[model samples]
Target: MDRVKLITIPKIEDTRGNLAVIEKESIPFEIKRVYYLYDVPTGAYRGAHAHKEQSEFLIALSGSFEVVLDDGIETRRIMLNKPNIGLFIPTMMWRELDNFSSGSVCLVLASDTFDESDYIREYDKFKLFKST
Candidate 1:
């Protein structure tokens, strides 16, 4: 399976800069939840897990970061810095986030509610589970 998918957010350019918008019906799925991660200390990492059924879109609202994604057989890396673009993560893909710039903000939009049971946190376990 492919690891990460990039969705081109529709951006309306302006004299000031640019603006991007995300609507529930416009995406592949409805937006059921929203969250963000920020204030990450230097040399630290986040999001070492995979979701079973939830799909998500991640945007770099500020600064920059790297999103590393892995399926059972393949892996991919994406650099997110622009607020107008988003990385779409499908279900059952393992992901790890790192290389965060100072004051970086990672915003995530989910298709499901907060459910710990939908997450696979261990890489080995995820690989094994995907095989079955």
Candidate 2:
């Protein structure tokens, strides 16, 4: 299975504020679509599915949240609370997002446009696909 890891977005520090860049070299894949989650209710979760062809880059743009990733055999949890850091989720990895703090904003950069056929939403189905 492919490994999930964190990538640091290059930051330019300034006395006024800071800037984080997500240009071509920022991530491995070209960003085809962009979206974000905001005002998520406490205890609510997001993204309980795996993709077949699309890769994703997730950033905690505002507050904090936890991401649980499973590669069929093993599971991992990561907390995102920084705007300049991001998590890269490759294809075939099942992920669940949770523990969103108030006002948390999650920015996602996708490698491809939305396609229902590319999603593997069931955990059982995900396991079966990984076993093959």
- Index of the highest-lDDT prediction: 2
Q: Candidate 2, which segments miss by more than 4 Å at Cα?
A: none
Query: Per-residue lDDT tens digits of candidate 1, residues 58-110?
Result: 99999999998888787888899988789989999889999999999999999
Rate residue 57 of model 1 by lDDT: 91
The collision pairs in model 1 are none
lDDT of 2 by residue, 1-132 (tens): 456879999999999999998899989899999999998998899999999999999999999999999998888999999999999999999999999998999999999999999999999999999889
**Candidate 1 TM-score, true structure as reference:** 0.94
Worst ten in a row by lDDT for model 2? 1-10
Query: Number of clashes in every candidate structure?
Result: 0, 0
Q: lDDT, candidate 2, residue 69? A: 94
Segments in model 1 whose C-alpha atoms lie over 4 Å from true places: 1-3
Per-candidate TM-score against the hidden true structure: 0.94, 0.98
